[model samples]
Target: MIFSSQHLLFSSLLLTGTIMSISSTSWFMAWMGLELNLMSFVPLITSKTNQYPSEAALKYFLVQALGSALIILSAPLMMDMDIFSPMLLMALLLKLGAAPFHSWFPSIMEGLNWPQCILLMTIQKIAPIFLISHLVTQTSIPEFVTFSSILSALVGSLGGLNQTSLRKILAFSSINHLSWMLIAMLLSDYSWLIYFFFYSIISASIVIFFNLQQYFFFSQLFSNPLTSFTKSFMSSFALLSLGGLPPFSGFIPKWIIIEAMAYNHMFLPLLVLIFSALITLYYYLRIAVLSLLLMTTKTKLLSPFPAQFFASYLTPSFLFFNMFGLLVPSFFLFF
Candidate 1:
């Protein structure tokens, strides 16, 4: 229900590409669809007027281009082509900003506003996951996925340790999430898809709200009135979900994945993941502390735009997906 023509176009293209990438057996066709999705997003990123938008656009383009090149370079290799598949997996990991290759992610998110970052963090994850699923069985990339994800977890936790930028912290969190996603991708393909959908839903809502309030996002809106206490409360709840605490949508998929991995005897990686999650929790709490440091002052705020009937309807729909992630694990398959 997004209204702008350009917004609709990119969304359509993303949908089309996602479907095409997942359904097709031929890797080439899937890659082409990914290309289509990437080209489609350039306009969306550049359509905004802010300086951060331009920087985000450039960073996104360069990173995508590099990953695209890697995939294309490996096109000639056979399915079981030892390191070739690893190379391709690495490309997807890089594209997704998974560990070791994750430096670009924070910079990119830092430049974009909240709404745009929400789009990047959510919808953009689908394509690479699709590609990873397709290549997983045919290659020896599971080890890589496990290792990379561990790195991602470590980076996600440690990278944002002192970051003051709100979006950058989220970006690192996104990188950390990728590790879990890639690990999940090793088990059930459906797991990855469902995890993505629900996480995206909750995240988009929270980011949009953050942007609307213009409260300490991307080094701006520093004059927030939401006291540190309230921020800590919301941030804690958000981080708990992010940390995959039970009862929150974020934890269910992670719980399932950890079970799946343990069932397969991936003890070391699972332990690594758990440790990294602890690390991630630290930074998230750090942010919470910052958020909690709000002034004990209140001021009258301006009347913001009234939620259109459509937005009112849409908001709950999006939010429900987040809740759905927590509540009904099998809900997506019904759709």
Candidate 2:
């Protein structure tokens, strides 16, 4: 995406809205913030050059509007009626695209650009998740959320298995990660925050790499001869990291969550999560192996040029973090 003053304005509003929602003390204020966020993001999704973005914006708007409506309608009744708590939880789950309600997420992502997809997967999630944490703390809804988390893990992992679109794959991956974060939330207060922080970093790196290469589908990795070995390798490594391979930065959060879950005697959900993660890793490894080992040969006339100064520097820096970032958790553990 091209950066414009308009984009800058909406982006700022988006951040402001998220901050407002997360920091709000009352449900009404939080609803206002969510509305601000929804409106700001719709403008960002609609693009002048793309017809699909308009469709995506409409779908996104409808889903979010429904969730917001549910939230507002249930907020007043929440204190008086215990039943409304589940209604509110459902609204937030719909907003978060947690499973059984996650069908719209990949379709919406399919129509978006990389940056918009990144926002959908990461920043757009913060408020709803924060509110869900609040709800979890106040209510006895572990069975409901646990079921959703397990279903989300299964759906997210299975949904991406046959996808060719990179956007959709990442969408499913986000849902899968959402399961883990939900589990983390149940395990401890700050563990989910730690999971989200690392997840955002790894996801951003992978999405940026995809954006730089203008790759939309898996086939592009194998067919695009312009992709150099170094670029391919770096991207593959990043994908592996995002898949939560051991020793990578991405695994640290998972390890922490696993340890926490074990301590809490949450074996069933932990087993399901581990199984789903392995399935998720399969696809990532498939992509990495195809891109790195079976790469297409570069033609002489269509040979790739040397990497740009900025990309050359930036790619390695991202890879460095992904490779050695595990040291952060390790350092704390030992010291």
Candidate 3:
């Protein structure tokens, strides 16, 4: 009972901070809201009594702290300048898990169990990205943001290539998604919102799907594979969908963003972006293929599900978001 209440309170505070960040006009107020969001989430990261929890909590806290400090220090400059602060904006990128400053993402993801990672990867991302988009008009963020977007996509795709840990692969995938998100950031304000909504759903769905499986490590994919064809096919679809292959909701945002990029005539940038997509697809396909080696004598067939903290939160919730994104694309045409 105590644990339940604590969880409620923490979540409430974090959410309150997120909304406040969105609504705030004062740079200071937005900064405070970010701090509030960060502090609230720290407890969640450390809530579990495990080594990974403690380490993840520390990494998350330190990265956030550094990012927050940069924003706060730059606050005074922007106040007098009328122009949006580039440093503060860059700091926001770090906080949002964009590249160059993205080293923390995979490590932190490595430390958390999947549920926490899911939340961190999805809903938790909403606040910072929201604040960043809000501040875009105050500065010449388009070019700088564009560069970061490409970097994030390149790094994410390359980083995941030979990864053997499930968490690390998802971590890299999250980074790749951030690259697309940064592009959305440059295109339109609504684009960011649309990207966030869909991205969160897709990420949460993928994480939930992964959480249901037996293996935790990436190399373990072939070690013990799913014997049930239903489970195997569903999991494969989820990964493929994550790759933004057609028919699934995952492809919806990619289609929109690519179209949006083309409309903007960002030809060279688009070329770079497509290449990164290919790199990401390569790694994702590798995992899917390995998981299929379930029947081979070289690897063990899977066993029963182990009780995990994130498993419950992932289900139904994931199913809802996964399907929701598929339908939400209709609204974009009018925009």
Q: Candidate 1: misplaced stretches above 4 Å?
A: 79-83, 218-223, 226-236, 289-335
Q: Quote the RMSD, in angstroms, for model 3.
A: 4.9
- Write down the TM-score of every candidate: 0.82, 0.93, 0.86
* Predicted model with the maximum TM-score: 2
lDDT score, residue 40, model 3?
A: 89
How do the residues 183-249 of candidate 3 rate in per-residue lDDT, one tens digit apiece?
A: 8877887776776677676766677666766457865555553344334545665677787767666
Question: Deviation in angstroms for 53 in model 2?
Answer: 0.7
lDDT of each: 0.72, 0.89, 0.77
TM-score of 3: 0.86
Q: What lDDT is reached at residue 79 by model 1? A: 54
Alpha carbon lDDT at 77, candidate 3:
84
lDDT of 1 by residue, 51-97 (tens): 77787898899889999888888765755455688778878878778
Give the Å shift of residue 160 in candidate 1: 1.2
Model 2 TM: 0.93
Model 2 lDDT tens row, 233-288: 77888888888999888888999999999999999999999999999999999999
- Residue 8 in model 3: shift from native, Å? 1.7
